[model samples]
Every structure is written in structure tokens, then in C-alpha cells.
Target chain A: MDNIAGHKSSLTWAVHISVALLVLLWLLPTLGLLVSSFRTADQIAGSGWWAAPFPQEESLQLRTAGPDEMTQDGDLYVIEGNLLEQNGAGDLDISAWGTSARDVSAYAPGKTAEMRGGETMTLEEDGTYRLTSAEAFEGRGERVFVSATVPPEFTLDNYERILFSDDSREGMAKAFFNTLTVTIPATIIPILIAAFAAYALAWMDFPGRALLVAAVVALLVVPLQLALIPLLRLHLSIGIGKGYMGVWLAHTAFGMPLAVYLLRNYMVGLPKDIIENAKVDGATDFQIFTRIVLPLSFPALASFAIFQFLWTWNDLLVALVFLIDASGQTTVMTRQIVELLGTRGGNWEILATAAFVSISVPLVVFFAMQRYLVRGLLAGSVK
Target chain B: MNPALQGVIIVVLAVAVCVGYFWSSNQILDRVIFPAKGEKAGQNINRANMVRPWLFLFPALLVLGVYLAYPVVETLRLSLTQRVGSGYEFVGFDNYVQMWNEPKFREALLNNMLWLVVVPAASTAFGLLAAQLTDRIGWGAVAKSLIFMPMAISFVGAAVIWKLVYDARPLGQDQIGILNAIYLGLGGDAPQTWLTIPFWNNFFLMAVLVWIQTGFAMVILSAALRGIPEETVEAAIVDGAGPLRVFFQIKVPQIMGTILVVWTTITVIVLKIFDIVYAMTNGQFETQVLANYMYDKLFRANDWGVGSAGAMVIMLLVTPILVWNVYNARKEMR
Candidate 1:
């Protein structure tokens, strides 16, 4: 029995190790991207974002006041000042300091320097400096360089550039709104239609109901790509052409099968007793659906909404066929990110920040309503 | 009129009003849905039954029919027509013949075959493995959730994240892509385009979907694993079967139905796998599957006839799988 327990413990360890490794493997790249987003382009180009904090040392040229303020004592003229203010934007870990670009960081940050022919320089923590020279100070400049420890801090700079700056080739702000315009209506329209259909299919008891369900199930296997051209041509023929409205309609069309399937499944899982009771009370099918089914189906609706919203939000193919206008006005966030990757792919900061922006809403919604999703997926489990 | 007749008439009137409202709401919804639920209320018969289903089904069925069903039928009809420059001419199975001969179409078919065989198998295998392993440990739920987190990521978003990891620069350059970096770190020469390598690239791309789906597999398999009656396991133990033998001999057969269901569900998604391939490689370098191939010919190349043929072929390839799935689902129901 002791041996048996020991064997089980060993097996348990093996499982724990594998799970940990899997989680790390899955998370590392995303974590790398998140870290990379806060880094400068040069650092990103140089090393993995994981190494961002320690290896990231920067040097900037700074100037200090020269010998005019130096009081002549015997033959000594000295000049000293710290070039970096408390608010210096450059990031570096200070090991040394220097008075020349070639010899940058030659001295420590607090170290005083003695020059030849009666000159000395000193720098303080507050970035103040004192200089003394016996000889009159001439036109040559005083250079002060210091290095300091730079902690990793996230910045909104990438978001600023991607969202507002004209320099961005794929301006996310416009595309973001475009995606919302496409996604919201696309999600809403399908759910609205699917709910009514679901109510009819699940509770209303109609002929061909099984056929409709089977047809829907079959349609689920129909690749959207197969329908893109014909659908586009149909759109063009109908004068809706390629635009927001066209894309919205396309998404709604694509979204409907799953919407109806999911909603029907959820509605069917609903207690038949409640629906039947409503009917016996003469509440009417529509009233029963609206007042009882709709409210009870909230979790399912939210789950499907999350699903539809994410799909429509992330859709590029439908938009590519129907919304890919030369004008930048109709571009969605996914398309914008794709183009950005093509052009500014090297900029992890921009890529990560942009990705986070695109996914933030979905992430929030998922976390907030994850319980609904879990229950919805297993709606018929006990049955 | 009697009270029953009056009630029936009122219900019929209500259904008519709902159907009429659906018709006028949007043209897309009207054509798809009104036909499904719409029948004019009879003047003589009682209205309760006629109006009841129609009033309940009108809005939902209308939206589905217009957006989903109509497009499906229209796609089928359009598949038979040849588009020359700007106009379509009916061309029957010529498109089908063309699709059969198209090299890209063949590659797409092969790639899809690879996807169907690989993704579900790998996902189920790993998920089952993880589930079994985690069940031994206590932290299985958290581990499963962590793995499943990727499923929450949108396809395009996942593509974006992976693109950063697979980033390639010139030879002797610092590798930004994780795989390339590891390769370089092992004293190897510069970057390789992971997404652009044919044949193997399918596996690489399949890995993404697998990553996203394994969590789903783990969840279902975990439940199924838990569902094995402890009494059965105890009986197996009493028969002197080791844990491994008991798991294989006792637990597996009991949960075989769930395994197939999960496999089939994922198989359906894999059959329509255009997004991952499109987002990652745009189906370049032998990475093109049927869905992407269909999209290219249909939307990019504007070869409506061939594209439709491809679509039909996809439907054909998937039908057997669907039939098997329905059969399994029915068995499970029983």
C-alpha cells in the first residue's frame, strides 16, 4: 500500500510538470509581445523582449556649464555638472560617466574629474555642477554623460502613434470604429433573427422543423469561401455593392447558421414545462418567448453574442471580399493589423499595443461573462 | 363568432401582423425568413395553430433564411455558372472539371486532408493526455483553463501574435521569431519562414488551431474521464489490473462516444479552416486549403464557376463526415 501511494505520487508529479510546461509554452510568446510593446524599436530589434530590462542601456549626449563661473585659485580651473535631470527620458544603468562621446561613461555618476592644466569638474545627484579653471575658459563645449538604472515601464506611445498619429500606415482608430460598425449590427441582426427562429423551432411545433434543423446543421459545413463570390456578385447586382452595409449583411448571413443552431440548442434545453405552462395560461407563443424565453435565454444569448462578436470582429475574409475598398475609410481593425504587420512588422511595440487594443474588449467580455459561456456550452449536459 | 373562434382569429391576425412586419423590416430578412414561417391566415379555420408557430418563428427564421439559407442556395446555383470578364454564363460541370484539374485546387484538397487528419487527432490526443495526466493531479481545472485561454483569442488576433513570434529577418541577423531564435541559439544559420514551408507548413499552421482547440478537448475529455464510474475502476482493480491497464481497458471504452463526438465537432471546424491559414500565410507556399482556395478563385480570381465547383466538392467531401457525425449523435442520444 505504501508502494502504491508512492507510485501514485510520482505519477502526479509527472502530470504537474507537463501541465506547467504547456502553460508556459502557450503563454511565453504572448508575454514576449506584451513586454515588447513597451520597449523601444532598437531594443526590440536587438533582443527578445524578455531581455528588455537588463540589457537595455542607453547613452545620451548632455552638456554642462564651462569655466566662466570658475573662481581662479592659484592655477586651478574646474567645471562640473550632472547632465541628467531627475526627469531625463533616456533609460540606462549607470556604471560610469564620461566627458567625451568616445569615452562616454568613463567615470561613475558621482565621480569628480580632474583635467590637465588646472581644471576640475564635479557632478551632483541633483544634476548641478561646479567648474573651476585657472585659465580663462574658451569656446570649447563641456560634455557630461551619466548612466542610470532603467526600470521597465510601459508607455502609451505606441497607442498614441497607432491611434492618432498620421504617420501610421494602418491607422487603427478608424478601423476600430469600422469594425464596431460592422460587428455590432452583424451580431445583433443574426441573434434577433435566430432567437425568433429558435423559439419557433424549439417550442412552436411546426412541420419540417427537423428538416430545418438538419439543413442548418448541414449548412454549418458549407464553407463561407464557397459563397463569397456569388454573394458579392449578388450584393453588387442588388446595388448594395462593397461597403459597410455589404460587409454587415455578409457577416449577418455567415453568422446566422451558427446563431440559429446555438440559440435553438439553448432554447430546446430550456424547461419545456415553463413554455408549456405559458401556453396553457394563454400567454401566447410570442409573449412566452419575449417574456420568459428571452430572459431565461440571457446566458445563451450572451454566450452566442460573445461568439458572434468575436467572429465578426476578427473577420477579414468577408471584409476582404465586400469591404476592401482602396479608400482607407472602410478598413477594419483586423485588416489594419494585417497591413501593419506587412509594413511595420518589425515594430513589436506597435504590433503588441495594437493587438492588445483590438483584443481588450473581447477579453473583458469573456472574463465578465465566462460563466454564461461555460453553462451555454454544456447546456444539455445533465439531460 | 364563438369564443374559441374569436381567440383563433385574433391569434391568426397577430401572426399575420408579425409576418408582415418581418417582410417590411429588411429585404435580406424578408426573402430568407417570410417564406419559412409565412402562410396567409385562413379565413375559415381556427387561427391558434396557424398563427402560433408563425408568430414564434417569423423573426428568427426570416433572418436565417435571408442571410444563411438564401445565400447557400444562391451559392449552389452560382456554382454552375461561368463568369467571363464581367458576366456569368451557365456552364454546368465544366467548372467541376476545371476544379478537378486545377493544381492549386489539388493542393488545397491535400492540405485540407492533412488538416482534417492532423488537427483533430493531435488536439484530442493531447487533450486526452493532458486531461488524464491532470486528473491524477489536483490542479487540472486551472491547467485546462490556462490552455483553453487561447481559444478565446480571435483567429486574426492569434495570427498577429504568432506572426511576431515567427518574424524572420536576413541571415546573421538577430532572430525575433521564437522558433528562429531557438534555431539560431543552437548554432544554426539565420531565419526560416515557418509559415512558408510547404507540406511541413501545414503542420505548423495546424499547430495554431490545435493550440486553440486542445483546451476544448481537454475540458470534454476531462468530464468524460470523470464520468467513468468509480465502481468500474474498482472492479478492474479487484481483477488485479494496473492503473494504466484499467484506464485503457475500462475507462476508454465507456467514453468512446464522447471522444468521437468531440473529434467530429472539431473535424467540422477543421473542414472550414480558412481563417488560420489565411491569416498566417495567406495560403501561400503550399499552405492553401480548400476554403482558402475557394476564396482565392471566387473572390480574388473571380472564377465563380470553378470556385462554386470547389465549394460543391467541399460539401461532397464533408457529407460523409456529417452523416457519420449525425449517426454518432443519434447513438449518443439513445
Candidate 2:
């Protein structure tokens, strides 16, 4: 296609560059969160995540030994300590030092700066400092300003806190399991139910089959929002009120339309001769369906399973209304993340970690079974 | 009982029951009700086959009716009635009137209309650009996958991701958010809070949807582009058409049907969008959409009448696409 008439070589480079920029634009946001999740709170607050891999230059305030720690030796009051050790500035190399905020890096490291009252302070490259005064030290510690190069640091503490800690308020471990509980059943149940219905619509001789298929297609676009109040009312009137069972049932019901639509479309495309041959052998419709159509529709079934798994796993609305009780033990990952977003809005470490935890599973499933997912999308849409 | 154990038990029992029903019903239908060895086996077999389809369809139909179909009518009814204590009172159109009078509901409706127009169009356009460009390049698949990666992230997750992008600090402090960083880098005076600004914030929220959905549009449209026959494009090039002309005139016109399908599908998704707005702004600074507005009425305000009315409005917006899809399906079936 590129070799076709009127295709310019420069335009090819333009296309490549445009696509690169677009992909970068698309990836940067999620990458920011991913990078942030690995950073400490102070590190995240200090600099942007894009600068995480490089050493950062920052101006920090340091204090010398207090007057109480000074001693008079040969008519000179002397104070000594390591500025980095006192400030807990781990792994930072001081390039310059100063006595005032007006010029934070006025003097190089290892240089001596003369102070008022005949005081002299000398700071070294390794953060060791000495202060000498003719008179005895009379006040609190002297403030020293330093500009240091801090090495890039990363930690897994955010994940450990969000996942392994006993702090239930921000932990995603419980919601992770709850989402699995909702997803597995909701995904599996709909497949068998829809498969049978799809087989009937595809193979079996029945009146109103086309109308039923059309109804399923129409039901495809009905917003699940409408189901919230009515279904909640029904669930409350019955024994099941906002628990795993209600969510699974709601998801299964909601998923039935697409499950049936995709599977029916796939099953209808099966060779007619196969069903006819099975019938010639005196096999019942049930036998033909179970033995022939079911095995043949594996791709379609897998596609819908992926679809339903991703949908139910990523869903917040269904789980919010149907599953979670006031006890909140039944909360799923999406809901938990939303809660964290509200309460921990400014805490990027917790928010990024929580968001990543919730998004990781579906991403794994998506990439692994992308073929089936794409197949499902093409079949479900573009009909 | 522990919910996890209960979940396991329910899964096993549900699968067992489904298998058990299908096996026994088929057995009863063939062996007892319509025994092929009997003198009247022919008529009995005919009766059995007719009943078997409904048996297969019963569970799915039951669920679809009780869950999806019933809700539309029930929500409409609930919208008309006022919740009087535990029961409901018939107050026809009062909820709609109340929703009409409310400022928030009007804001939500207008925002939804804006979303309905902007998200689909922008997504489709970007998706088309991605599809056409990617198809011409060697490493296009990787780029396409990266763009499509956002489809897997949940809307709540996306809201968090974009929130960081739009984050703002005070004038003196460093800007961590990319949007603010870029703004300040481009000679802007101060870092702006992207989500809090009125009117424009809606576009910020819609950007998240567009980001997530463009990959979807790209995948479908790419497939459609590949499906387009080679001869038409070749003929267009032979007729002195440039690459751009060949694309817009020849390729796009051919995939118009697919483009429309993608548009309507995304339009349906945008109409029902809740989590992005709910998580990002929660309707603050006039970013309320219908789903979030409905959620506010039902849960926060505890007004069932107005909430149900809001649900009806969403349902009403979806009705045209529903009718269009059903009509197309019926047409294809014939």
C-alpha cells in the first residue's frame, strides 16, 4: 500500500512520528500513576514522576549542633556534627552550602563561611560540619542551607500497605476477593444460560425465535441504570438485599443480552450440514446441541466470557446498588477505589496503588485473551 | 457464612442445577412424554421438539425479562408515582415536573447532550485516524495496542489517572500534574485546576472517555478498513486521487456503515456514563451527567420519584438506538 501511486516517502515518516506522539500521549497518564505507585510520599510530593529515574537537585534546610552540645576548648566554643545525619538526608551528596535563604548555594561544600560574633562554620563534602566561635554558644542550633543531589529512590511500601496491611479502611485485598466472587459466577452462569438459548435460537425449530433474537438485540442497549431501582426494590422485597447473590444475579441478567447475541450469531454461522447429519442419526436437539454446536462455538463462548469477566470486574454501578451492604464487607474493587478517591484524593501514593491493583487483573486477562476479546467486539458490534 | 465460601457453594450448585435440569428435561421429553418406541411416537416426537426450544430459552428469557425488560416499565411507573412511606402514591408526571424545575437535572441533561455529541465524534475521529495511520506502518500493531490499553482500565481508575494529569499546586510550588506543568511551561501565570473550572471541565471529563474509547473505535474501524476491497482503492488511485483523497472519498465512504455502528455503540456508552463524573467532580462545578444526577436523587437525596424520572430520561435517550438496532436485526434476519 505504501508503494502505491502518489504515496510519498516523507508522509511515511510523518505517519510514524504522529503515531509515536499519539501513543506517548495515550500512555503518559497511566504511566504517571504506575511510576507514582513505586515512589515514596515525600519523593512523589517533591518532584514529578517523569523525573523519577534521574537524580534530583533540591535545596534543603539543615541545622548544626545546638549550643548545649558546644564545648569551650582553648578559648573557642566548638560545635560538630554531620548535617546529613542530623537531617536524615539519606544518600544525598551536598554540592554547596550557605548561611542564608537569599543564597542557598553561596559557598561550596568544604568551604568555611565567616559568621557574626566571630563565628566560623566549615562544611565538608560528606556532610560533616564544624562550627567555632570565640565566645560560648548562647542560643539554639544554627540553621544551615544546603543544595544536594538526591539519588532516585523507589519502594514497594505503598503496595505492602494497601495490600498486606491490617488497616481495613484503605486495603484493597478484601475488595479484590469480592470482585472475584462476583465475576467468576456472573461470567460462568451467563455463558451456559445464554449458550442454551443461543443454541435454541440458532438450531431448534421454534416460533418467535427471530422475535426473541431481536428482543435480545434491543435489550443490548437498555441502560443497566434503569435496572437499579426496580431490581433493588425486588431484591429487598425478596430475601436477597444487597449482597453477592444479588450482584451475581444482576450481572448475569445484564450480561445475558450480549452473551445471547454473540453466541447466537456465532452458532448460526455453524455448518447446517452438521446439525442435519446429527439429526439423521436420530440424535435429539439436546444431543446435537451439547455434542456439536457447543464444542464448535468455543471461540464465541470464550469471547463472551472475557467480555463478561472484564465488565463485571470493572463495574462499579451494578456492585454499588446490588451487592454492597451498609456493612461494606461486600465492596468490590471499583467501589473501593472510588471510596479511596474521595477520602484520599490528595494522597497520590495510595490512590495510584489502589487504582493499579484494581486495573491489573483485567489488563492481564485482556492482553492474554485479546484475540477472543477483539472477536467478541467485532461480532457484538458491526452487525 | 463467609461470602467467599457461599460464592463457591452457589457456583457449584448453580452449574449442577443447570446441567441437571437440561439432562433430566431431555430425558423426560424423549423417554416418557414422547417415547419413540410407542405406537403414537411420531406425534409425540413432534410435540416434544416444539417444547424443547422454549425449555432451552426459558432461563435466559426469564432473566432478561425480570432484570432488563421489567426494569424499563417499572422505572417508568416509579417515575410517575411518589413514594409514600413504605408504599407508592400515583402522582403522574409530577416527578418529571420536579426534575424539569431542578437546576441540577437541567445541568445534567445539557452536559449529557454535550457528552453525547462530543465523546462519540471525537472518539470516532481519533479512532479513524489511528486505524488509517496504523494500517500503513510496520509497527502499527504495537501503537494500536498501546492506545487500546486504556479500554481495560476501569472508569474509576481512569478518573484517578486523569486527576493526576489535571492536578494543580499553588503558584509558587512545583506542578506535579502534567496539564498544569505544560500550562506553566507554555508561559501561563498559574497552574489551573482543570476539573473545577466551569463548562470546560465537562470537556476534561469527556477527554477521559474519549481516551478510553478511541482504542475501541480504532480496533473496529481497522478491521472494517482491512475488509474494504483492494480494487476500489486501486481504482481511486488510478483516477489521479492522492492518498488523502483515496482515504476520505474511497475508504471512509466504504466503511460508513461500520463508522455509524461504532458511533452509536459509543453514544450508548456515553449516555450511561456515571463513574468518570461521579469520581472526578461528583457533579461539582456543573459537570453532572444523567447517571450521576439520577444517583444523587436516588441515594444522596433519597428522592425515588425524581431518580426514576432521571432513569427514564436515560432510557428515552437510548430508545432510538434500541429501535434502530432492532430494526436492523429484523431486516438482516429477513
lDDT of 2 at A188: 92
Q: What is the DockQ of each candidate?
A: 0.29, 0.83
User: Which run of 10 residues does model 2 chain A get worst, by summed lDDT?
Assistant: A1-10
- lDDT (tens digit, per residue) of candidate 1 on A11-126: 66666898889878878766777777777675677666666767544455566654444455566655544455433644344556677777777776567887675666776545
| Residue lDDT tens for model 2, A16-125 | 99999999999999999999999988778878889899887777887887888887779898998898998788767889989998988999988999988899999998
In model 1, the runs with Cα more than 4 Å from the true position are A1-6, A57-153, A166-168, A379-383, B1-47, B136-138, B169-174, B187-191, B326-334
* Fraction of native Cα contacts reproduced by each candidate: 0.46, 0.82
Please identify model 2 stretches exceeding 4 Å from their true place.
Answer: A59-79, A86-88, A95-122, A131-146
Give the per-residue lDDT digits (tens) of candidate 2, residues B108-146: 999999999999999999999999999988999889999
